[model samples]
Target chain A: EAGVVQSPRYKIIEKKQPVAFWCNPISGHNTLYWYRQNLGQGPELLIRYENEEAVDDSQLPKDRFSAERLKGVDSTLKIQPAELGDSAVYLCASNERGRNGELFFGEGSRLTVL
Target chain B: AQSVTQPDIHITVSEGASLELRCNYSYGATPYLFWYVQSPGQGLQLLLKYFSGDTLVQGIKGFEAEFKRSQSSFNLRKPSVHWSDAAEYFCAAFNAGKSTFGDGTTLTVKP
Candidate 1:
């Protein structure tokens, strides 16, 4: 089975532009997560979804960030009027129900806000 | 809130030499620990995990980690490093269905 999949491995846009990232979790996985990794740092949780419901999203920057995991399979993360600080790698990960905290991650989308 | 810390930002070792990366965590509950490796332009890959039982757990790519509850640490080790082992390694602690990762240690294997 394929691992989690993410699109647009790399992206470049000017500050104040809108950007979106897409991800398709592994088949049959019930949990999905979005994380942001800055240069030289480990990934930080942005949001988490259990099926169609977003279980945890308190870490997400509501001012410009939004995310959805429709149908509990695929997910999308968007940033409107992106700022230079938003430039980072957006990672998507998934886990099977009842699994012991093992998360399969995608290659990640690297966004550069100029 | 639970958190993980990797004191070393980077490490260098000669190929075929033994290697170890330290990881420390702070959590209120029994910690589910993990080690992940990430190559350039690649996704995070699980090396090994420690949930319960034996303190020492072996993982993929000849990696192993020892969990010490007393120290609140789960340090990764390899008997002999290979050039391909050069990558960023992250130590994580899982809690409440979420995992917290450290800053990551970049390993460089010298020829």
Candidate 2:
């Protein structure tokens, strides 16, 4: 039983450059989530997808950040013209569709904007 | 809107000593609570969760949490702390469309 897998464990990009992170959720998991964790702070929900539809994305910065979970199995989060403040660990988690279940997380992609 | 609060920023405990971390949540209906732990530069791991049925829920690693509906609190405890337990813990709750998380508490275990 493999867990969620995220690519490019660490990334460094210029402030004005574009960056993207990818995640492959666990098999049979119907729910996917993207979270941003800042220094000394908890991971904040950025977006959620139940299959191909993005159920929630109010917290995602529409101006620069965009995410899509095509086919509902894998997801990619992109940040264009990245800002210094955007530097943080981006985590991807998966869970079975239900009332409430434990969310299994990947190692996460740590981004650093220089 | 649902939100979680962790009052403690950091706590240090000696090995084999009792440990407790506080968590408070705000929600409209019945609350669904969760505790997650993360090691250095790692992703968050589920420690435990409580939806209903029992006031006290036992989690992995000999950790347990008590949910007090009246006080809107769900504090985690371990009778005897271990060095491997040192990590950052987060409390979270799901709301209308998304989940909210606390800032987190960093635990340091003294050998």
Candidate 3:
């Protein structure tokens, strides 16, 4: 089976520009997660989806960051007028329900804000 | 709040040498533990996991981790290091339907 797939492996944009990242979770997976990983740091959870419902998104910056999972399979994360500090790797992961949290991750979309 | 910590930011080992990467977690109860490896420009891959049974868990790529409840630690170990083992290692803890990851440790294997 194919792993989680993310598009635009690398992206470069200027500050105040809008950027979006897409993720396609593994087939039959019921849970999806979006995480941000700054250089030299571990991945931090941005949002989590159980099917089409976003169960945890408290960590997401509502002012600039928005995410949606359509049909409980594909997810998109958007950052409007992104700041320079937003440069980092956006990682998408997924797992089956009741699987003890074993997550399968994607190659990640690395964004660079100039 | 549940959290994970990896004290060593970087480690260097010679090929064929033994390796150990330390991981510590804080939670109200014993949480599900895991070790993941990330090669440069690649996604994170699961190495091993510790749930409820045995303290020692073996994983892919000749990696193993020992879960110690007394120490609140789950340390990854390899008896023989290989050059391909050079990568970033992350420790994670899952509880209450949430997962937390620690700052990774970069391992450099010398030939």
The lDDT leader among the candidates is 3
Off by over 4 Å in 3: none
TM-score, candidate number 1: 0.98
lDDT per residue (tens digit) for residues A14-112 in model 2: 899999999999999999999999999998889989988998888999999999987889999999989999999999999998846479999999999
For residues A76-99, could you state the per-residue lDDT of candidate 1 as single tens digits?
999998999999999999998888
TM-score of each: 0.98, 0.97, 0.99
- Cα displacement (angstroms), candidate 1, residue B57, comes to 0.3
Q: Mind giving the per-residue lDDT tens digits that candidate 3 earns over A1-114?
A: 899999899999999999999999999999999999999999999999999999999999999999999799999999998999999999999999998679999999999999
B66-110 per-residue lDDT for model 2 (tens digits): 999999999999999989999999998865656789999999999
In candidate 2 the C-alpha lDDT for residue B22 amounts to 99
Could you report the Cα RMSD, in angstroms, for every candidate shown?
0.8, 1.1, 0.7
In candidate 2, which residue pairs clash? none
Residue B14 lDDT (model 1): 100
Q: Candidate 1: lDDT of A22? A: 99
Structural similarity of chain A in candidate 3, as TM-score: 0.98
Query: Which candidate ranks first by DockQ, i.e. highest?
Result: 3
Question: How close to the true structure is residue B70 of candidate 2, measured as C-alpha lDDT?
Answer: 91
Q: What is the DockQ of each candidate?
A: 0.85, 0.72, 0.87
